[model samples]
Target: MTQLKAGDPAPNFSAKDEQGNTISLGDYKGKKLVVFFYPKASTPGCTVEACNLNDNFERFQSLGYEILGVSADSAKRQSNFKTKYGFQYPLLADEDKAVIEAFGVWGPKKFMGKEYDGIHRTTFVIDEKGVIENVITKVKTKDHTAQILAD
Candidate 1:
């Protein structure tokens, strides 16, 4: 897997949103994008991150940034999570792990003293010109939005 870094062009992809709409990187070509990859839907840490993003949705919008959350969860699960949390942004279903692999966020993880392969909680901030502006690899779930916005 090629690890992406700041100043690199973000790997482009098209994924289905919660509402089953096709959203592609090209669609947001001229806009700043916050594309976050998390392990699962509705989990404790994931929930905190998602909710924090939702709560600060407007602020991101005001800054002309679009938010997108991607996971290996099924479309149904993503839809349910978005509805339950009242999220204003799109939560994409990457069950095939294509986009995850493309972004190099799928890999081994350690949780509770056990090692396993899973999605890394990472966020990529793509600038308006489609270049990666910043990468938040060690994401703090609770203060995720603030951390990204501060970038």
Candidate 2:
């Protein structure tokens, strides 16, 4: 996968959120946005990462950041995940992988010694003008907020 870096122009995307609302990059025009890509919905690692972000949701908002979770899951699955955890932010359902490929997070991955193509866990902090301020490829699932705040 082509890994995005800090200062790269965040690729534009328009996908449906868990609520079926169309969320586009342009919507966050004048605000910083946190776009997190996870491999799956309700998985162990994904759960921890998502909950950590949600637990600090208010703080992130206070810091002027709007969060959006993305995954190649169906809208129903995304909705279920969000509802189960009571996540405060919208989770994008990128079933078509359009957004995933745009962000360059989809590629070969190894798990338990088996190689396969999948989505990589990544987080992008986009500035008000839509430029990436930081791209966390080595994401700390439980302390992601700090990574963004550190920038």
Candidate 3:
């Protein structure tokens, strides 16, 4: 995977959110952003990571950070996951993997001795100017917010 790093310019992207509303990176201009890419919606690790961020939504907002979740799932799936968990932030339905590829999180992964190409669970912290400030590859699902904050 061509992992993005601090000091890199975040790729510009536009995609439909879980609600089927158009969302673009431009929408968050001049604001600190946290773009997290999860493998699949409603899955075990994904759920914990998303819920942890949701539970600490206000904390991020208070710190001037806008959070966004991304995945290569269909809009319906994304919507269902968000509704079921009552996530406050928008989850992008990157069905085409456009956003996923732009962030360079699509690559090989291993699970239980099986290897396959998939979306890697990654998070990017972008500054107000759209430059990456941090990239978290080893994520702690239950304590993701803490990790981001600690960065």
Best by lDDT: 3
Q: After superposition, how far is residue 41 of candidate 1 from its true place, in Å?
A: 0.2
Tens-digit lDDT track of model 1 for 2-54: 38999999998998987889989999988999999999999999999999999
**Model 2 residue 61 CA deviation in Å:** 0.7
**Model 3 CA lDDT for position 122:** 92
- Model 2 scores a TM of 0.97
Sorting all predicted structures by TM-score, with the top scorer first, yields 3, 2, 1
Clashes of 2: 0
Question: On a 0 to 100 scale, what is the lDDT of residue 39 in model 2?
Answer: 98
Better of 1 and 3 by TM-score: 3
Report the Cα lDDT for candidate 1: 0.92
Provide the lDDT at 37 for model 1. 95
Better model by lDDT: candidate 1 vs candidate 2: 2
User: Which consecutive 10 residues in model 2 have the weakest lDDT in total?
Assistant: 1-10
Q: What is the full ranking by lDDT, best candidate first?
A: 3, 2, 1
For model 3, residues 56-99, the per-residue Cα lDDT tens digits are 99999999999999999999999999999999999999999999
**Candidate 2 deviant stretches above 4 angstroms:** none
Each prediction's TM-score against the native?
A: 0.96, 0.97, 0.98
Clashes (N, CA, C under 3 Å) per candidate: 0, 0, 0
Model 3 regions lying over 4 Å from their true place: none
